[model samples]
Target: MAIRDDYIKWVILITILYRVGTTNSVCELSVSHGDKLYNFSLASPTWKYPHGVLSEDGFYKIARNGTVLWFQLCDGLIFNHDPPRCFDCQDCGGPSHCGMGCSALVANPLGGYYVCTTIGRSSSTKVNLIDEKNPSMGVVVKISSSGVLTNCSLSVSVFCDSNGLQGPNLLETVGTCDYATVLRHPSGCAKTVSLHGNGLGWFSTLLIIVLCFFVAYLLAGTAYRYFSLGIRGVHAIPHLEVWLSLPHRIQGLFRSLIRRFRRPTQGHRSTYSPVNF
Candidate 1:
């Protein structure tokens, strides 16, 4: 990180040369919250133009809902139209299974599994985390609901996925998410349970609809033809009745015509009759 000449005055005004370590130098910046001032360290092993933006490994941004830590920027709108990202830690605020933080059956950092910190909830609970732009030296401040300011790193165990960079003053950090064991350790917070849906799939729904239609067709023909269901002084569906009685009606009409033709007619019953033709 390199500091430019333009920002020199601001750096001097912001920090008062807090500490000068032999190996790694550290500085302090005061973050204002209303009437109070919160100071966090800005440390780096090497120097670049005296002062600059403290980046990864020395400066980390910390955010949490209850016990779970967060590191990634929740994606913007356009995914399922839901405002919250899948890995959002805000969901873990309350003491309930719904507060398991993230839900992923696998180890996917985005949405594959949930990385939770709790005690005695379960031994098989999965841990999923999101740590992206973690600062190395700078401290991230969090304000409680009562308007009191707090450094989140001091109280919560930051589940980091970085390469060996532990930000200053983090209470406890399980360096890699993989380092967090399932039931191997406890953080006093209880594990949250996740529920999944087992509803019918597309194939099942289609199959059910088809079966219903087939059953309805069979029942309509059989029941309506026999019972008639008090159907009297009203118009009936034409094709329905025809479809029901077509076989019997065709046989009856054919038999009547045959008998008429076989019976003696005017030409056959002629008075002289008996010609030897």
Candidate 2:
């Protein structure tokens, strides 16, 4: 009973670990697309400055027409003061809102701030991120969010650059609310191994762990039986009877199945058949 309980405990541990390791999180920094894996783990919200932007304050800023934009890459924007009020402003100040990437302060006809849009939410990375349409062009990390007040949506495209660590470079603004940008970081480059495909996948790794645990269980159980229980010879092996009988049990099962499925044999044919037509 103790050995069986040990076996159960090990199985439960493996199961929990497998589920936690394999489940995808909404804010995963690494994504696998096609044959290559892109990892943005290096890019986090803790950066002192936004990529490519030279600002004493920790965000990239852009002004076009009457609208001003503040944004960050792989992080939420930092503000010294409260941001302008907008429909999405209620959810502002966090990664799921204006902080995730892009926020816009739009000007009204009367010259007052009209609305704000939190264009990129970190939580959307898992669902919206995709590989570049052209592999040769390199990886593109696209993140977007539906507007809180307007019909428009906001998007930011992060391109791969070998030197992108300086931060992301804002390339252009689309219409009144969207953005295009480039990030030249090594993480954007293609990887030979996938996020889960590094040497072995989660399933394979778990399988190996289970096998190791099983072997350890056998060894430990056998030793206990030999020393503590005074079991002798082959009988000292833990569950020796079960192991020894497994082959014969398997054979019996196969034979039973075969008998169930096999065609019935006809009665022995008469050595001399009756005269045939």
Candidate 3:
């Protein structure tokens, strides 16, 4: 062992990045929500594919109600309109299974070992996952609803017949029902629990609006007062009148004294004037 270890001398290389090969290469996937479009490929093991599953080419874009963490085979043959179901062997003298007499199953690239037991759910609790070597393609989505976890699994192999990818966040199912629910509905919980007090949100919004109005009124009043002061300063400020005592009575007495004492000068007519003592 020592001699072999010495012979196999370890060589060290220095680099900033290293690369690993993954079998997630696929044609294209396009997903759409509303008017937006997004494009993605299944070539990265670390990459999580969003929903666009069987409807579009390789692009999908929208605020999703659910997410697609992994995408397996996406083909037109099996998943064109509806999901696949086993019909010929509904009661074919054996336990129920998927792909019993379906022509599509018979022509599967993988030997008839991997059976399609159920379209949506299965009795078995454990589900097996695979890579591209066996031509197995599937995707699992991890649904988080108010922190509750749920798994949704879909076999893309039956549809695409090609490649797939899986991420750490991808969920694996224990039974077919779990898988079916995940694919059918991605969001685990239909209802969300409130983190804060109920109706507090609306109350807070209303309070903010009221506060805004109050502040506006205060500002307007202050502005009006200041504006009036500014106007008085800009134009001339009016002065109040002041009074002395009994000026009108004194003026009447002086007028009587002047009338009794004064006589005409020369022939000139008396000039009219306010009487003064």
In TM-score terms, candidate 3 sits at: 0.19
In the range 84-195, model 1's lDDT, one tens digit per residue, is 2223234333332322322111112334544432111111221222121322222322111111221111122223222333342332333322212111111111222223
Winning candidate number (TM-score): 2
TM-scores for the candidates: 0.19, 0.41, 0.19
lDDT, candidate 2, equals 0.52
Which digits, one per residue and each the tens of the lDDT, describe model 2 over residues 120-199?
65444432344545442344444456654543333444444555454444546675555655545544444345545458
The segments of candidate 3 whose C-alpha lies over 4 angstroms from its true place after superposition are 1-203, 231-277
Which of 1 and 3 is ahead in lDDT?
1
What's the ranking of the predictions by lDDT, best on top?
A: 2, 1, 3
**Which 10 residues in a row give candidate 2 its minimum summed lDDT?**
45-54
- In candidate 1, what residue range of length 10 has the lowest lDDT sum? 72-81
TM-score-superior candidate, 1 or 2:
2
- Greater-lDDT candidate between 1 and 2: 2
Best by lDDT: 2
